[model samples]
Target: MNALGLVVEYNPFHNGHFYHLAESKKETNADVVIAVMSGNFLQRGEPALISKWERTKMALHCGIDLVIELPYAFATQKANTFANGAVSILEALKCQSLCFGSELGEISSFLGANEFLHKSKQQYDELIKKQIKTGVSYPTALTNAFQELTNGKEILDLSLPNNILGFHYVKSIREQQAQMKPFTIQRTSAGYHEQNFVSPTIASATSIRKSIFSNEGDITNYVPSVTFQILNEYKMEKGLLHNWEQYFHLLKYSIMTMTEEDLLTIYEVEEGLENRIKKNILHAQSFQDFMERIKTKRYTWTRLQRLCTHILTKTTKQQMSFINDSQTAPYIRLLGMSSKGQEYLRSIKKQIELPIISKLATFRHPLLELDIKATNTYNMIFEEPLRSKLLKAEYATPPIRL
Candidate 1:
């Protein structure tokens, strides 16, 4: 069976995701659609609005054939690292093509951008470093470097969020020499980070999440029936949607109690950031306030959030350092699967490069350790029996079979 792969964070499996899933399969002409989805936390360094299993059920109900958890080590990293890990998992699954939604919407543009960067890698690196030295954010430096290199030529725009991730996906595929062909579809209606509704039916996940959090507008039209139902069910059962603000006190406590020396050991804590964090922790009122207190031109809010996530989870530099040294994921963690997905897995199981892990107890790895820890930390936001129940579910729940 031919499988098409997607790198996703469903968050709540909104309509935009539904469109992407359908388009990906149609574009690739594949028999099954497989997704490498983030677990508990996201690339932007925020806790998922719901649990990974909840999101997995959302995916399965939305017609996704398979869902594989993108381990904590990669799920919360920068775009390139996130793409690398997701792409590697897809490649390991023997996918025929990997499709992503992007502003550019054209695969050629991503391919060209990757080729250009590969050819001018040293120059681009120097330009990025030069821009960074001037106190600009890393993303700004990247945009400036890309502009300088392209010099008005129509290459992929690195400034757009989806395009940036798309470029990285293409780059990773090339770097790994994977067989999967890369494909892109134009994102419809809403931008990746747009927090306002742009269409009646096709709103960004950001907008969907904001509306859900604020309890303002009805999001029924913005997501599929399954998504709406699952989201409501999750909220009813879990009591609240997960968010940074919900975890702020614990994060504050973590920062307040840890010594500066100890905070420095957390991944991404560098150049006396620990000092800045210590100085700001006492005065901040909320996660937003704390982020504003520490926000600087050099460190993007997203970057800082990832740093905070690391701190909250107590993920040490030593642990992440080991992960960065590896080229590919150590295992493929199956989160959920439809019957078709199971058939595809059975077909590829013998030749797949990584171990296919369905049960947590059956598989062990240094990376899996971080995933478990992240789940534990994520569950901390819940009260009493719910917290213990969620934590127990992590080990006891089997992969969802649709």
Candidate 2:
């Protein structure tokens, strides 16, 4: 049984996502598709608008054979860690191939770029640091440095979401020497961060969420039927990230009460950003306003938000070190596996180098505890009271059958 793998957030399952899923199977010619998806918090450091189980059900109903949860810790991380977490899970599942969406559509080019990036990372790092020291923001500095090295060819358009992520996937697979073939499906008309629907048939998740929150035009064309069904059945409310001003007040209080040393402890609080963060906290009214005040050309808004999230969760240097140390994903944690996926797992169970975890109760490790806490935090974002009510939530959610 040829099995393919996908890593996703499915923040809300939409038509464009469906295309990627279907095309992944067709491109790989695989009988089973195993997905490693984010639990609740997405990569943007925002809470998911819907629940993970709802998203999982949508995936199972659509085309996926199995759906594993990408732990909240990794889901809300930077590109490398996010990709590492997802790729490691897929690799552990013994998948034959991995597929994802790409704006450029040329997976070959992405692979080439990945190789180049790795070989040149050291030089690139130095150049970027030099640029940053001269007062450019990190994002701009990195972009400029890459541009200088690539002669504006390969790194000119790193802003596209899929391209950036696709690069990470390639990097992870190469670093791990995983045996999965990597494939790409071209993204449709909608851009990943588009906040407004430009077309009737295509819209970004951002745009869809905006529509949902604002109670705008019909979103039926953009999302799949399964997703719509879940939205209706669950009576899912919109925008867990709705009140930016309220969150900003929390951040302001937290930053003001905390010391400089405390601010410096959070991940991504590098190069004395704490000073800027401390200053920005008082002036900002909304979350976006705070991000704007903190934004230098070096630090992107997304990066800042992730830093804030890290702070909110009180992620220490030790935990970050632990994540880096446990580089090779030690286990395949099955969320929901289908018959075909089970067969595939059985075939390679002996050859697999890592442990496969199904029951969290069996393994009482610190890492598992961290994972559970992250999930609970995610649940808090789901509905106000559900977060507390959903502690040890996975024990109740039975493995989905296909």
Candidate 3:
């Protein structure tokens, strides 16, 4: 069985995602579609609008054949680390190809960019470091360095969000010497961060989430019926959707009680950012306000949010040291699977390099422990029984078999 892999968040399975899934299958012509999805937290460092279980259901209900949890360690990281982890999982699963949606639809550009960067790595690193010294965000520095290196060349645009991720995906595949071929499809309609609906059916996940959060604009056309149903069911059961604003008080409390020295132990808390965060927490009203007060050219809002997520979950530098040492995830965590997915796993199970984890009790690793802590922290937003119920589900809930 040939499997095609996708690195996804599927925050809510929207029309755009549905289109991407379909196109990926068409492009790869693989027997099964596997998704390495973020768990309770996302790459942008925000708590998922719904739990990963719900999102898994959404993925299964859509076209995804198998849904595997991208562990909290990798899920909430920056682009390079996030892509490395996801691509590693796909390779370990013996996928024939990996497909991603990017603004630069052509796959050759990503391959060429990777080759160029590999050949000029030392020069590129020096350029990035020089650019970073100008107080620009790391992402900006990367884009500027790439443009300067390629000067007037039509290489992949590093500035676009999807393109950046695509470049990282290809780079990881090369670095790991994985056999999976990389593919890209042109993104349709909405942009990655577009918060307004630009199409009747195809909208960015950001816009879909914005619509749902504000309780304005109809999202019925933006997502599939199953996604709409699952979303409504989640809200009805949980009473409210998860968001940064909902956890602001808890985050502020976490910051208030911790000393600067204490925060320095948390991953990504460096260069006296702890003091900036501590100083701002006193006067900031909401999560957004705190972010605005603390954000500077050196740190992007997404970067700060990831740091806050680390602080909230108490993910320490020691706990995240595995990332610097290894690009691959230690295990493949199964979240849900369809019948076809089950057959594919059965066929490839013995050949897989990493342990396949289905139950929390059966797996014991610091990374997996962090995933549990993340789930616990995410569930803290709820009241009483629901909170306990969600936490218990982490262990008791088996992988969803469709």
Candidate 4:
């Protein structure tokens, strides 16, 4: 079977995602689509609006053939690291192509830009150093470097989040010498953060999430009916629906309890960021307040959010370095899959390079340890029956097979 791979965090699997999945299939003409998605925490350093199980069910319910979990370590990093892990999984799975949505849809243009960025990498690095010295943000420095190197060519615009991630996806393929072709579908209608519905059929994931958060507006107009229904069910039955801020106490407690040495061990808590966190944790009222207190021109809010997440989960620099130095994922953790997906996995089961974990019965690994801890940390938000059940579900729940 020709399998298509997608790097996704279908936080709620809204209409935009449904559109992307359908378009990716049409673009690739693959027999099955395999999605490596984020778990409870996302790249933005926030808890997912719903549980991964519900998100997987939402994807499978819509059109996805298979869903895999992008481990907590990789899923919560920047665009480059996030793309690297997702691309590596797709490559290992022998996928024919990677299908994703991006602001820049023209393949030829993106390729040309990719080539220029790769060739001028040294020059770009120097420019980034110079610009950073000038006090501009890293993303801004990158954009400036790209413009300087490309001489007004619209390549590596880094300002657009999707474009930045798309660049890294292509970069990962080239660096790994992977054979999977990349196909980009032009994003339609609303912008990445735009909250208003541009078209009923096409809306930003941000807008859908905001609507769900506020419990206002008709989200059914933006998501599939089944997705809405699942959200409703989880909202009422489990009282588990959440945003990032809900876990402030957990994050606060984690930061407050850790010493300087302990904080330094965690990934991204470098260069006295520990002290900044320690100082702020005593006074900051909420996660937003804490982040704002810690954020500087050099460290973006998202970066701080991710760092805070690392502190909450205790993903150490040593653990990250081990994964980096090894240049391989520890395992392939399946989240959910449809019947077609199951058949596809069965066919490739013998050939897969890493362990394919369907459940945590006897699993014992540092990476999986981080994943479990991440869930336990996220579950701190729930009260009573929901809290314990959420914690147990990670170990007890099997991959959704539909």
TM-score of each: 0.99, 0.89, 0.99, 0.96
- lDDT by residue for model 3 over 1-402, one digit each (tens)? 889999999888899999999999999998999999999999999999999999999999887889999999999999999999999999999999999999979999999999999999999999999999999999999999999999959888899999999999999999999999999999999999999999878999898889888889999999999999998998897798889999999999999999999999999999679889889999999998999999998999999999999999999999999988997899999999999999999998889979999988887998999999999999998899888988898999999988
Please give, for residues 1-402, the per-residue lDDT of candidate 4 as tens digits: 999999998877887788888988998899999999999899988889888999999989897888899988889888878888898888878889998788877667667787887887898899989999987877788888888877886554668988888888888888889899998988888788787777867788888887777767777788889988998998898765778678888888887889988999999887778788899899999877877888888888888888888888888898787567755567889999999999998998888888889889767788788889999988887788878987888989998988
Which residue ranges in model 1 land beyond 4 Å of their true spot? none
lDDT of 2 by residue, 1-402 (tens): 788999987868898888888888888899888899887667877666666777888887888878887765677787878998888888887888999898888688877877788899899888988888987755567567877878878542566778878888988999989889899998888888888888878788889888877888888998987787787776644334332343455567778899889888877788588888888788777887888788876677777787887766666666666677866455566667667767777777887776667777666655555566556644443444655456656666667766
What's the C-alpha lDDT at position 76 in model 1? 93
TM-score of 1: 0.99
lDDT by residue (48-91, candidate 1, tens digit) is: 99899999999998998999999899999988889889999999
Each prediction's RMSD to truth: 0.9, 2.8, 0.7, 1.6
> Candidate 3 versus the native: TM-score?
0.99
Which pairs of residues have clashing backbones in candidate 1?
A: none
Q: Candidate 1 — what's its lDDT?
A: 0.92
Better of 1 and 3 by lDDT: 3
Q: How close to the true structure is residue 303 of candidate 2, measured as C-alpha lDDT?
A: 77
lDDT of 4 at 388: 95
